[model samples]
Target: MKTRTSKTIGVAASAAAIALSVPLAVTAYAQPSDSDAPAAEIPDPQGPECGAFKEALPNWKGLADLPVSAALASIPEISTFNSAISGGMNPAVNITSVLDNGPYVVFAPTNEAFAELPPEQAAYLRTDAAGLTNLVYYHAFLGLLGPDDVKGQRPTQEGTEVEVTGKGGDIQVNATAKVTCGGIQAQNARIYIVDQVLDPAEAPAPITPTSTSATTSVTPTTTAPATTTAAPTATTEPAPAEAGAAEAPAG
Candidate 1:
């Protein structure tokens, strides 16, 4: 899929262009904490009996036995993702095949998650098949990634890799998009239903009581003013200015 370059056309051009536009203040996708929490802090949803790598365990119906394409298509929650991946920019760009050939981990965004994206824009990408196709590859990992194995930077069909963090049930993609449901297995792929679509941009990088302390360096405390407000550094002024952030839409 990396060979299928992202074309700068229609909505695709706008998506890529935003990367070089003014770096806006985005906090939605930055690491939730200044530092990674101890592994124990993150919760694992499955009971003690289930382990990440254990044999398929129980999945919805018998999805594990089905082909990756049919498995995902059967799920109602991620219909938007399935629909887009089913089609291509044309016959030449077959994304469905890329996903079908696993062991791939597809981070499928739910319908509500897709709704969070700009309505017109999201629908357009589904048809134009460039912006979302790049994003689809960006979200996919070409191997079977179980809960225990989901951490660390994973390669994608797209050029840029996604950094997955967290433990067990609390796993996240790029340390933002919460995996609402995971460990769904298909014959060739493992599907993870995520609450948020981890877009390519740094989440557009919260909140607190009273913060009047001044520090010379950028130090993110366990508690802070807002996601966008960091301590004023020695060389720069700290205004509530827009700095680059994550994928969620901005007002």
Candidate 2:
């Protein structure tokens, strides 16, 4: 009786172990290596071709589906963006930074804009990091405005407000001059090429209040009081004064 009981217990334990092993083997077969996992999605970039200028930059094939920065970086021009830092014309870099949160409608002045600046200012933009950065920011907009979207007034990246006007039924971004190229769409940035370059310094400065001390110094002095003719000081009638001179005469 004892032997039979022991044999039965051993068989049951063996079956349980076999069942566990089968599930473990199935799990191992189903698992895959990290290396064999799917690849991440990337964006594509496409824009209108304008001669050599377009080809020099890398063809961002998938930029339309990508984040604005990722798309810009994919372009060949972005690699040379630092080189473009000359004359403080760093619009390329500036556009990329702001585009992350924008559907910015930007009037990207051609390299000519920087060249148009005086040599001294251009030199400072290229060499002075802060100036270069500010100049670049001045050209960007926070909205995703397209050519058709431009209307009324919009503020510049520099915080100066500018009025926009269109031509030939087509809209253009203008401060003083017309933007030549109409539009180039990026993931979030709508870039347009301008024949004339923008000059942030051209905007007028705000009026400053005069200091109290200066106002006091400019106060007008009091004028002399006006004198009138005394109206003949009792016009006539001092005549009797001599006649009446003596009451004693009457007596």
Candidate 3:
């Protein structure tokens, strides 16, 4: 997987100069068939969501106090996403309200992400509430999962599971979509701003984690005929360049 770049507005700013009394750490999911992971208990006062400083944020309230709907409105780069959710087209459905109550993880696509969609497809999603809502639901995972919390393959609420890989800051959704900016929070959920819109129908097959058995097979003491043959393991080791890639080191 590749390294994640902070696409959330202000992530590149000088947070150190802001000098908040509280120190925050930055950290780093998905599916097409509606993700329904159980809500996690990670504390809200401080979370990986606090990846960057926002001078505009209210001093008395943290992002955890606001709902997902409100949080989307706060980020400028994802305004198209904000508009799409708000405009889910049908007056009968309230995408905003659903997000407001979620402890869900939303892999929010940016305005540019939306622009990447085929004109016809984008137009249809915007006009059909059920279609739009389903698409949004497909992008979310039930419960709060930060970057550190995301691992392996997890089912989505939309109707299938998505593959998540990488640790720390370099997370990949379906092994391709990159987390441009991650860990933004709402009172009930978390956000990972992704560069591409994830589709369950098009997602790659789930990734199977490397099994421990492969490494331990050498431990068996029996002189099995297979053991007599020498196998090369030079390819299994991590390359030198991949050693400590994180969401960009603090600074």
Model 1 per-residue lDDT tens digits across residues 124-183: 675665676677777787777667666666556675667677756777777678887776
Which candidate would rank higher by TM-score, 1 or 3?
3
**Which TM-score value belongs to model 2?**
0.47
**What is every candidate's alpha-carbon RMSD to the true fold?**
31.3, 18.3, 31.7
lDDT for model 1 comes to 0.66
lDDT of each: 0.66, 0.53, 0.66
Off by over 4 Å in 2: 1-63, 69-95, 167-172, 204-251
Error of 1 at 190 (Å): 1.1
Q: How much is 87 displaced in model 2, in angstroms?
A: 13
Error of 3 at 249 (Å): 99
Cα deviation at 204, candidate 1, in Å, is 13
**Candidate 3 C-alpha RMSD relative to the actual structure:** 31.7
Clashes of each: 19, 12, 12
